[model samples]
Target: MSIVKNDLADNSLNDPHRLLRNMIDQVPDYLFVKDLDCRFIVANEAVARIHGFESPDDLTGKNDFDLHDASSAARFSQIERQVIRTGVAMIGMEECVVDAASGKERWLSTSKVPLRSANDTVVGLIGISRDISARKRDDFLRDEQTAILEMIVVNSPLHAVLDRLVRLMERQLVGVYGSILLLDDGGTHLKHGAAPALSQEYCGAIDGLPIGPGAGSCGTAAWLGESVIVADIASDPLWKNYRDLASRHGLKSCWSAPVLSHDGIVLGTFALYSARVRHPEPAEINLTQIATRIAAIAIERKHAEDKIRHMAYHDMLTGLPNRSLLTDRLTQAMLQTKRHNPWVSVLFVDLDNFKFVNDSLGHTAGDELLKTVARRMENCIQPTDAAVRMGGDEFVILLTDLPENTDAIAAAMHKIRAAILEPMIIRGREFHITCSIGIATYPQDGTDAETLIANADIAMYKAKEAGRDGFRFFTPELNIKAHERLALHDGIRRGIAQSEFHLLYQPQVELEFGRIFAVEALVRWNHPQLGLINPNEFIPLAEETGLIVPLGEWVLYEACKQNKRWQDAGFEPITMCVNVSARQFHDQNWTSRVMHALGETELDAKCLELELTESLVMRDVNEVIATMEELRKVGVSFAIDDFGTGYSNLSALKSLPVSRLKIDRSFLRNLVEDDDDKTITAAVISLAQKLNMKVIAEGVETHEQLTFLRENHCDEVQGHLFSEAVSSTEIGKLLQNQQSRSGLAPA
Candidate 1:
């Protein structure tokens, strides 16, 4: 509102001078009257105290330039002159001005009215201002926190968010610089998070300060998990170690608070440094607290998200890239191969007999062994290469930047095998392990991720079959085999479903009497298109594709049914032997399966014998024996087939509850000349008899071999000597012939 002509003379109160002065001084707001020269003609107590004066008389005749810094005083004089010259009243103008008391910026809601004389001529301005510094500071902090939290929720760049935070903190405190120092990944030293106000040289000097008691304010705060306030860096004992550095940077006072996560984890530190040596005010402390809380939220959220992604893409046991990561990297490598590296190799590395270790040493030690192997594989590869764990004991190493030479690839594969073969010390015992690696290269072993991995897997199995520890590259022939294997697997599945599979019985003759007392039921798949498919091809494929569980069940039930039929037909009673695959043997429900077949066929468990290979028995001897004992209790007997092959030491034989042992055909095929084979056969028979288990000989095709078996006192024999495999009706005829020759009854 404009001043009126009688505005200064309207009051008629008694003792007006002292009354008006006391009233103005007690208002708790700054009030003053300025002359045409912008000098203070009258001042109140609030105005005096704000300008660093004890009494209003001290500022009575002083100008704005005398009470404030030149910049602030000039701004004030310009605003007040407009009110005086235009005779206009400016209302509610918020402006920043220097506080002469603290030498810091303060905010004011100021209003100025032009004063007029009795003639209505403008004279000077009357100023009234209310201190709004605290309110403005709170509003600024609220707005900034909201903005930073929004950024954090949206997953903004961490450095950018923290930079804005540091600058916001610096804005509230005069001459105070702000920094946020993040703890390094190792949690040992500090790394720069944000330091927008600090000099580059100073920031670099303290970037990696290890957190400790006397390692400056930020470092000590981080180490102690508490706020550290060094009021005077030049003389404080906490800053004694860093005093020289502080002096070089003109930093005199510092306050630092540890930034802690919600779980009390130390994420970093928030620090405020002042150029002048002084204690921090309440406002400074409040900003430090708010800034640290916000920083903790930002850092902890980042760390939590990062940890989530890590767990998703990495194997839990070995901390290596899992299959998903393997596929991703393979795709990226394939895309980059033509532009960058001459070749990209995907090595399918599988540990040999990992299940044996896992069962023998317990899963705990097995996990330790896997972790050790993973580390060795990592060390064997370059930084550009990735070592991924593809579940269980399988791994894949992706190699980039390879020379197109076969020799170099061979060298790399050999190095990896050598590293893997080194003894790993786990849980206070040293153990040896080996890996079979299959190499599939870019532009040669198929182009896509799935095909390359598949080819490499095929090559790996081939290497395992070649020997225990070896490396082999994928060949075109291997792909053919792989495709054929896939076809056979599918065919066998369809064969079982469509009744294309039937049984052929090979008679196992009692050696001393020459009577057919038992027959081994072998499976034959008769495809409608390709004639009879070989068991030699499909058996292994069925096992590989996990179709053995169903196929073996069918074989078992069919064999028992055939044996029951023969007995029902008034033939001599005989044992029916069924070959069990390694996969089926390891199944948890395998015992139940055998019992179910016996019950369904109404066959005597006594006449049914399950034949397991020596390798399957040795895979996990304790578990195998436990299962064998369970079956043997129900009157079903077990036998070790292929006794001379695969883990054929005498140590595992004596404890097994086996009723018979079968010599593998490989030993019998060359027993006429190979002394080693003869010795092994004789030893196996002797070992079997000593364990009170009757032994049988397979592949005995000649009378000489028969004589050899008789010399060894073998209990039974089965081969082409009597017959190959025949049909059920032919088996019936063979059984009748045996009975006629021996003149035996159906007993």
Candidate 2:
């Protein structure tokens, strides 16, 4: 009997049905086997428990249709048929079912596999089902939450975000309607963001409800910075005043949570309303709080980004568009011009002599001047145009869809000039300023932004040179001239190093006596390639290139040395006059330069005269007077050269330590014929005499002009009447002849 029992036990362990049953029972998931007619042929303990049956026998030989709802049974049949036909395994499909014994709705995740014969012909099916009701519910809730969050973030204007959030929660959560109320600046009022759509009229009644203890659900929540719940809106003290509005809207209960920022500052409150008296679930309250916090972040970020963009494009000082934004607009305009072949103009304007005004007046006045100019420029441009502050005293005007004929550009330039010249009152003083404008047109001047800007800069410099308070159009000739000037500047620097320079002396003859009284020292350049270059050509070049400072010093030393030689050679003490440029005269070290030159040459300070133009005297009268007085005390004299040509002030001249007034060549050129010239010359001579100053007439070409000057009491005359400027060797011979005529032999 024992041997027989052992054989039976071996058979039971190796039998396929017994082995399958044991494996199925060991799995955590519910496992079952069904026949072709869909009856459960075998069932594990898990499967029996899943169906709310007492044991495996309870579920055996029963179809899923007998155990579940028709829909659940139909879906399971479809999956089983698919798996059988394909002889494959199906995985993780979810379905809803009603428990047979418990009569409760439940969720299950199921997988099915075909049980095939040895020849691979399907005969039955094996399936696994899991109790996934908790997981499925959690997933559905997560998707709902995510969708609500997305709606809030995407909708704008903080209020809209709150409105969307309320709608989402009302649809998802049972027995829940909601409202959002934002706090005011003083935290004393509640501004409604959203309310239940059905109760919108009631929400409107309390749209701007005041915030305090017991005012309403939202107000109490905001005041306490915590949840405020009125389980029964009709009876709660918190909703005492709002109960009528709430009852009219059919709201029975209310719960409010403070909407706080990440830093815990209350921004608003979220309130839930129930159709019947009820308390909010913990999950419902938590979800509402999450939505409120997210709304705060979105609103704060939007405001911050808007503030940053404003600061980026606007000029802090004048509240105008700055260079960065202007450049971007200009680039877009240029691109449009290229694509459409339209005419566009860029006007680069620079305030003329603005530095002088800023230095003379205080910074406050300078700032006021800039603001006034900005306003005037803004008024001058059309609506289609943009006036931008390119920084400092520079501004740019962008004109689009302009006329191609260039007349519009000219008119624009005229407007700019007129606007800038309008007098402005700054610090109780009337001030006038002007601008130099450079106009560069698209397609004509350049094809790109950088090239256009460069051409405009060149044109601006040309306008300034032609004289400020005007504008110039970009031209090829102007660009070439700019390059040539640059080359000349470099060449002048080289000229000084190479010592390619010399001096000539023009005799200053006494007009009444017809004898040389003084000699005007003139500079001459003898270029190795271009010989004997005239002063008119290189002297202005030197000044513009700023080479005049060193060149002027050389001339002063040479002139002083020549005067000392003449004095040593028995000639009468004659004043040696050297023309000083305005730049050199205004230099801080000018007085020291003069003293050094006199000391080095051992020339009598009385015999050295520095000649300055009328413009220099009028620039700063007080400073000029001070400078002249200091030099006069050292025995050095001053002369007003090219008189009656600039803005000459007689009072300034009288106060200046001047010994001679040289009439400009314009007045002396036609003194013998032109009545205007003769009158000007005679008047200048009379004026100089009244001030006890000598009068020297320049540019005397003929004996008739010299005779006129002699009769007019002109003290000195310098021109071809005596001799043109000559070399030093020629000057020595002339001095010898003068000494012989005076019966004074050379030492």
Candidate 3:
């Protein structure tokens, strides 16, 4: 037990075995030999020191289980046994181990070979291992970075991504715990984003910590928009407020970096804590900055995604739930409706005279007024109820989990009405507006979202009908009407499919010669079971159900075909007039459909005149004129049906390709009695004559009405006065005898 000056003494040198052992002990890498039982037989100074031994002799006869953990010892024994049994070498095999005393992870590149006896039989193993922890650590960091970015690309939850982030940091710098705290929307407070390595008690205590100059590491870092380092939490002025909490969690130091967005706004903070009171090394500081950059990306991306989602589900102007969100909530509420007291109610609120405001004060002022009304409605409801903007001046208030008591529901409706009744200023003028609300309950009025909304809408119209500024619950009578309407809607589809509809022709008498000049074709539905359904009864229903397009097409084709058949039967050719629905007139393929009908029947375009309501022509004058011009090229002309009943622009009317104007029956009904009706009818006839358009007076039943129209120089007249819309065969017989009896009277 003696030593020389950095060398072995004379007595040690004399023993070659001692000199060789001394040289082997000075090797830096761990070198050892084990017997067949996996017990240490030889060891170097590095191996003994690493295992916390004073000398190599301390490790002799000891095994890995005695110096290291059971798991590490078992792994080592397994590797050695393989070499001993196979007499093969295991070279440069990377493995991990934990320090027995320090509890730190270390990676080693190990090589083991079988130790053979003189007879060349495997007896033991010789082993050597070198530390490769630093290289392996870098590899781990790259792998983790790739994994975290992949999670971000896939839009993983923010909490999950942050949790994995902190765990990755913990793995990179063993024993140093990590956490992330994000700022509130106001950017004045730090809330826990992730802290899986920290105690829940400690995290909860710091959840809503305010950011200031001296409010702990993460708070101060976020407040100052920079990094904050506190080597000793117990004594640092920044940690004074959180010292006790940190002490309870055994945290003595912390380093934090602000997670700033690309615009240099502080979004949150990334922090690392240690049990030992020491400042961070350069590597740890660099890692914190890396974590902050990553946190900024994830936080900003999450916020951006949230903003887009909000915009999708909410109205932009009113900031209320839109129809999409409302529909979802309504469906969910319907599913949750119980047979007990609590009920889900839909309140359809329509602003009274909103169109008047838009017309008087411009659309911009109308929009502002609607926004004010929206706010008032929102203020009238509880948090559980949802206020939705169903577009335009319409709003729907969804009242959920309410009492079944009708009185209570009416009170709520009263409150909403009262709120909207408040006076408001629009376009610099004080104006008062009121809203009409309709109530429909889930599982009572209707179950589905569309049905509930529609029933509520029908009820709202009923309220307006009763008197505006009132509320009404949907009635069973209204439900019956709705069902009948739906049945008729379906029945119309069946009627068309079964060919239960036919056209009737009414002859138009020429006022000059009294001969039948033309015929107006009217469609009548023979419902088979119901016998006959008037065109007025089913025509509007067809329009509402979008079936008017097909029905109108059938009328056009049949009318053209009948005219063609009559002409081929040796009868003089006459113009065939057919009424067109608004939807059919505006159809993109309308011109093509008309041409198809004419081609199918081989009818001359000049003999066909399409009748459009004045309102339909006035809808879009330029477009309507263009369509009429395209058809007018082939001699197909248009007649303004119900001319005086609509608000038509005379300037635009002058440009229409119209061949005639038919005075509405409403004005003609009282023409002989009411002077105003006579004045309107006469004015329309004079105007059509000045415009060089033929004027036709329909619904001329009485002789007095026919006399008034003839006196006004009406060119053509059709109604019961001219054989009350006879069938094709009867009209054909009339066409044969037109000269003998141009007396077009019912008698």
Whose TM-score is greatest here?
3
lDDT of 3 by residue, 267-308 (tens): 999999999999998888878887888889889989998887
Candidate 1 on 195-289: residue-level lDDT in tens? 99999998998889899988899999999999999989998888877899989999999999999999888899999999998889998898889
My TM-score estimates for the predictions, one after another, are: 0.53, 0.42, 0.58
Runs of candidate 2 with Cα error greater than 4 angstroms are 1-457, 461-478, 568-571, 743-747
Judged by lDDT against the true structure, how good is candidate 2? 0.80
Model 3 global lDDT (CA atoms, 0 to 1): 0.88
Model 1 reaches what TM-score against the true structure? 0.53
Q: Which stretches of candidate 1 lie over 4 Å from their true place?
A: 1-14, 30-129, 236-241, 327-342, 357-365, 418-434, 447-451, 464-470, 480-747
lDDT of each prediction vs. the true structure? 0.87, 0.80, 0.88
Of candidate 3, the 10-residue stretch with the lowest lDDT total is: 2-11
Best by lDDT: 3
Per-prediction RMSD in angstroms?
20.3, 25.8, 16.6
